[model samples]
Target chain A: MVAIAIARQTVREALRRRVFWIFLIVAVFLIGLGPVLGFLTPKESQTIMRSLGLAVILLAGLFITIVTCIYLIPVEIERRTIYTVLSKPVQRFEFVLGKFLGGFAIVFLSIAAMGAVFLALVYFQGTTRGPDAGVLVWLTSGKFPKEMVLGVVLTFFQMMLLAALTIFFSTFATPVLNFFMSFGIFIVGNLSSVTESLTTSKNGLTSAIGKIIHYMLPNFGNFNVQNAIIHPTTEISNQGVFIRNNIIYALIYSAVLLILAVIIFDRREV
Target chain B: MATVIKKYPFETVRRRMSLLPAVLAGLGLAAFMQGQIDPDAKQFHPKDNFGKTANGGLNNEFLLLPLLGFREAAAGLLWVRCDEFFHSGDYDAILPLVRLITWLDPHAENVYITGAWHLAYNFTDANERSDRRYIAPSQSLLEEGVENNFDIPDIKFELGWQRYDKIKDFKGAEEAFKLAVATKVNKNSDDFPYGAPLKTLHILAHTYEKQGRIPEALEEWKLAIARSEEMLARSPKDYSAKSLHEAEVRNYAENIQRFNNRYSTTGHDSVNPSPYPEVLEPPPGSADKTPRSWDVAFKPELRIVRPKVFKVGGQFNSQDGARIDVRITDWNYQDRKITGTLNDFSVDPAQTILIDSISVRKNHFEREMDMSKDPKMYSFSQDFYRVVLSYNPRTTAPHLLDRFGWSGEGMTDAEKSHVFMDTDPDRTGTAYIEGQGAVPPVWDGKTVPFTNHSQPLRLIKVTYKISREQIMNQKPISENDIVSVQ
Candidate 1:
């Protein structure tokens, strides 16, 4: 019941935010314009849909996650809202959980609305052309529409995990430092494959630097579900092996970073 | 419940957030597990389903309209944009542009169908000895269109016509024609002409003829003739009218003539008599003009003629198939003017007698033969050399009638002689007058009995007859043995 209350209040606050509406408008407009663009392209409608869908999800999700965790959280603290909140009957753990949930709700609502339009475009495109003979093969190829929706839901959770990491960083550091550190970590994490390749190179010094960057950054590439859309025909195994492996890696990395944030925040002279 | 709460440590806050990842991971795990035993694969062959759905979706009306409009614009742009490349005959430029246009508008089925068909049929494939490679792709494109638009007969007709006309796959063409005809009839449409049914009928007739079904072929030809005529009548007097009518009449007439000519067996009632001189009297001023020899017959026109050393290809029986230049400078040779058929046919392995002239005995003969077989070169019988051999057979002896297979089985020997005497040379070796004299024009050296005109020798009837065994067993010889029969 307590978890439910925290979830509901967080969801409500996110709905009231102005940034949420702005993101919603942009995403919706793009999704609606998909058919128009498809008409112009004539040949590459399906490919265009894929590129745009990925772009929308990544851009909107990142905007909501970074701004809420980095700017909003620090602003509330600077305004002494954290003191008032802490003075209340709510536990510090609940506040952190609540803040994470609120930021996630805003991102989720925006993604869901945008995703709905994007999915409708895909569905409309499919149906208007009549039932595809490939539908059966496509269903067998990847997670079906139901399973894909489940994947998307899981992806939102993945973004929430990243949000938690951002908040942890913002707790102790200045806004400037927080922004730099969060963005730097995000960039490096996304390019983990590049870092891994660098580490395996012949140069010892470069390999050392790559390794240090790898350890310091959270490997956010693990959270990417976009690859699934690109090659839906891929035979992803059922051992829960890859998904479990990525989650474990993300959790471990996020935990270590948050621990460091906690240590720094605890020692700060506020 | 309203009492003051303790501040939770950061570690505790981090632990609560951790459960979110764990739960999401569980969901993802369940989904992945479900995918392993995919029910879709057990029930269906995936590729077939994909093709069927792809075709079905492509053909849907709504899907086709926007695609057609888009493709038209796109193809137009591409045609202009790649103008230079196409002008240089670089097919690489045009092929991809057309491919892209088709991909965008698959249901604009005419693009691929018409494009490939025009490429093959109008240009390359229809050229004199049709190209198969060009035809195959053209047919394949039309076949794809047929499969996609199963109800449309245009693609079917195009495929069938190309199969018949270009590939010469008449049976396959007949099948496609049947399909198109059946489609048109069942659909009950008048606009699209059902050429297949008519084509099928024509092919059936052609097949019957090939199988030696003469009666059936005749009947079928008559039927086709009637049908084509009927179509010509009903059709508007368009540009094809005059030629169509002319072709119909000409074909019918020719077919009837051929039918009559094949069955005709009328025998020749009278043999053609020789046009050579009945008697040859000696010249008055000669040394041989003594009292006893005064009665000796001689041809007076033989004096001014020159003997030619002509080059002749080897006989049909020799392996070397050699050619020889023979010098014929013999002025007093008694047979200088061979009046009767001088069967100086070659028997020598290396030599062939080239007959240069025969104007009462001296006229030119131009001939060629592939000496792959031993050539026939036989000397005339004694009776042919007789002074009175051209007269009655009982009284003096007819020179031509005294030959083998003559009189009793006259037709057989006459036919053999006719076969040998024809001037149509074999393709392998050639014979020509190649000495220091003007090559004379061909002559049989005979005139009609009481007329001033010379007896005509039909040159077109001349041919070389070498049996397969003779051609195979022929031996080669040297060039020095070629002889000229003056």
Candidate 2:
């Protein structure tokens, strides 16, 4: 009950901030403008719109996730709200988990909102493309890029993981420092392909380091379903299993980060 | 001093080690997903560019947007720029940009198709004649396009049309269309999502007709009808898709009936009017004796007028009844050409090649071909260049089309003609079948299912090996330069 109350308070406090709204509004505007800008390539307009929509969501989700979550624990302690919450019989672990959850909820809700707009734009654009192809059949799965749902889901979880990392950093680090530290990790993790290649690299030292980084990082690249989503013809051997594995991995990693954060916060002098 | 001896310290260590299992599992899943998800992010992190990256190899930081999953949009924008290049008559600027757009988004089928079209059609000479030199590059681009996008028929069809309209290689067109018809949406889904595009089959039928493979043409028409009928059956209520295919079905059915009436009169006939004259057997005075051959007596001559320019004159007995394919190759191209049965659109850039055709008017054709322009396309930098002057029944003028059948059955040249036909179930051996006649050739760039074979294709082909010095005007041209092709 204490954690839930802290979580609710965290959510309310995060919403009052202006930065989250800025990212969300900008994201929506970019996604909406995807169609208007699609006139550049008449043939590939639909593909561009779909890919650009997901990309906008990811960019927006990146900023929204980091900005909202980075300040979660720092502001509370700075305002002495952590003392009041801790004095009210809330365990340190619950407080940490609550902040992470609250930040995650904001990211999820924001991405979901953007996802709806992306899908609506894709559907409208897709339906307009085919004069002969039946709209109902296209709607069923033909022309409609239903795989973008997976793209959006994957983006949400990717951002969710980033949020967890931010909260963990915020547990000890200042907001500004936490922002850079977490953003640096996110950028490195996005270079999953680079890390993967180096894992098999000829230079033994590089290979060893690559293996370490590849396994230890959040692996933001795994959730990039943009190519497979944009090109529906691209076959993923076993999509369901693939997505299930990624979700489980993200959840497990998020749990580990939160646990570590709690352990640190428990020993930290307030 | 005894602070380290606290007994509760074991619990702390145990508690810290408890999350290790979760961390291990997370790491394990991360490894597995990373292995499975061949991330598209590599496009952003390549090893080379011309500067910080390699030319054709990219690592531009500004290219980071495409790296972040906006590749198709980037490709779209670049293609728009390519369009501007096209409109401004900056044709030279389009090829490299096409390479970029295709790299950015390989699924942009229209980019490959349009870029190839521009390469083949728009690049022109001072007199507005298409620079035939660009044909090879356009073909190579389409071949690469087809290679990159095997599941879609669009590039394959574009290649087929390129072979058909641009190069006039009907055999190559047939092969490309055959490949196209084999593509499906699920295979061929791009448009249909469940089947290969029906037009692939329709065009395949037309290409077969052009090749004089009337029986195969009928078969393709029937296949087209069957495919359209299947589509119509799947969506009987879908007036739009069905109506579109319905017209095709009617047309194919009419063609099938027409083919059955004209060529299928004899169940065994391959082409109409049976492309056979009695090549009689040799028994001294036997009725099946090999007939005497007609001598068109081809005497082709060439001379270098100036640097990168040549005057080619060819004499034939037939007035306006023949055309000569004049070809210049980088030292040894036929050694490469003898391989692949289909004369596809794959031109290697490492070698220089130029091919053009001229019609024989009043038993002779004399024209000066200038290769001084477009040095990039025809860099005759090799020491020795081989010039081939040839005529084939399939691609020659309409007058020849009327006299000679698909296999050059009715035509003969004393010093230049060679006729061959497959003798057995496998085409390893070549000889005439007793009654089947000349419907099939030993090689017409198709039919002979094997990979390795020599081309006995030219009926009147003369190859003259000349030094590049002669082309550079260092060695003077002479009549003795003509080297008869054995």
Candidate 3:
């Protein structure tokens, strides 16, 4: 019952925010631009739509996670509302969990609504163009020699994990700090494979730096399945299995980050 | 201030609030979506004027504005498809489509080369069924591109290659290639990482070859071969560029050899050992008259027709209307003439040899065969009462088709022995002629209907049926086979 209460309160707060509506309008515009995008490309309309859809989900999710964590908790403290809530029998962990769930829910809703629209557009494009981009993707799947789909799924999760990492950081750091730190992490994580290669390189100092980066930086490259997905004809079955494992790994890693954020928030002086 | 506070802003408030954001947002969005909406917009407008970045990105980077990027990539693919059409001699669609692509993305260098080759070569498929009109537009587009982008060497190379391959204008090709070599190639490492020096070397080598400078071309091909070998040695597993270079060097060497062979008398008469035993040489001072055997033959069924096989330009059949005339000579004795009358002497299997007569001297014989009739079939006789020799009634199905004509279905013994005597099963083992007696000695009823055997014994006039496989396998035949009759 208490968890339900927290979830509802977080939901109410998300509804009241103007940025949520801004994200919703952006989502609608991008989704509505689907048919126009279809008309423009005429070749890879669905592929473009799917890619843009994923990006919208990511951008909106990031915005919600960042803005909520950065402003929500800080604003509560600035308004001295934390005292009112904390003076009650409520625990700090519950407040943090509730806030995180609220943000997660809002992002999930946007992802669901936007993903459905994107799929619908893909279906429409497929029917109109007579296997435009999406149907070719479908027919090429099982009929030919394709690489594993799991590798691609893993990469997608890895990107989502990066988003979660940003949210976790925003819980503790200033929005500007979180933004730079997350962006830097994202860039470094994309290049983690290149760094990992450097770890075994000839240059001693460079290898040392590479090793440090390999350990210190989050490897977001694991979630990238764009190449495999785009080239579905050459996918290996083993890669698909590998992606499933990586998805679990990314989720666990994100969970660890959330736990760390909760711990940090629990001990805050505010 | 009191005057300004008068109620004069009712209409202004309504108008300003609505129009300001709408116009700003609308303009901004329009600017963003301009490429998406328009097909012939400033798409792929060259940004890199060989040095400075054009618009936002270098080398037309801003031109890749997602909408245009997709189109550009598609055009690149269309270039490849157009090339296939051009190669298949589908010039009807090829010329216009290629022009459209170049108009869309003028920077496409490969399309120019491929399309130019199609037009210039005017090389038709075995079917020879497509229109010849594509050549004019193809050449025009290439010339236009050359005029438009006179600085790009790749375009000039395309022109030069087309001239050399299609028009046989080697001198003109050489001049164009030289011009291409003179172009200042991109020196920036990032612009062309492998650098243009190697590319220049290649162009120069091609120019030399086109100019008939064999020694220079051979040297260039060898150098390229050495460079490729070195690269391959360093990275044995890497197939990317090493294989391409190797293929180029090999093709260059082959072309040089072919050029040399065409002009040299030695190449004209060159013949390796025959697969069959036709030449007979006695051992030194031995009593045996048989030739030294390369392979041991026990009772080998030797079959030899008078006139030493068929000749395209030979004259006269045997006087007996069966046997052909021949002259025989022995190194140890005086040359002798053996003349015999060829009777019609129709047998179950009549050997068609159109002989005049045969004369036999002491250990010598000669016979003459006539070919005066136009694509006619005649029988030959060794003896007056009985035909001693008959054309092998059961010619292998593959043998007949390969020599006389390709029916492209099945072969019969009647067809092989009577109609297609030149058919050698061994030369073209995979193919067999079908529809016996229906197709003429030369005509099987299809496009470009004429074919000669590896030995050139028979001429097939094709009018019907497909050639099967592909005509691309012709070069390998001409290079390795095509026996010289020196």
Candidate 1: where is the Cα deviation over 4 Å?
Answer: A1-10, A40-43, A127-129, A132-158, A225-228, A231-240, A251-270, B1-486
Best by DockQ: 2
Q: lDDT per residue, candidate 3, B407-482, as tens digits?
A: 2122122222222323432222111122222233322223322232222122111111111111112211111121
Candidate 2 lDDT over B1-486, as tens digits, reads 221211224566467567667767766776666565554334222222223212345457536765465566676667768877878979778877786767667666788799889878886544355656567667767876787677777888999999887776777898888888777546315555544576777778767655545456656767766766776688788776676677666766654443332222232233333322322112235576453334567877888889978898868766485788788776665323322111233334355676677888898987788887866556777888888887766565534543443334445676533223322222221212222243344322246532322222325677778998999988886757766552
Worst 10 residues of 3 chain A by lDDT: A143-152
The best-first sequence of candidates by TM-score reads: 2, 3, 1
Docking class of 3: incorrect
CA shift of B286, model 2, Å: 23
* Residue A65 alpha-carbon offset, candidate 3, angstroms: 3.7
* lDDT of candidate 3 at residue A229, scale 0 to 100: 39
lDDT of 1 at A158: 54
DockQ of 1: 0.02
The number of clashing residue pairs in each candidate reads 30, 18, 55
Which 10-residue window of candidate 2 chain B scores lowest in summed lDDT? B426-435
Over A1-270, each residue of candidate 3 has an lDDT whose tens digit, in order, gives 554576578678877889877877787676566455544334345434544444454455545555554555666667877777766666655677666566556555655665556556555655333544555665455432122223223333544565567657766787788877876676576553456567788999999998667544555544444332332221123443444445555555565565666656654567
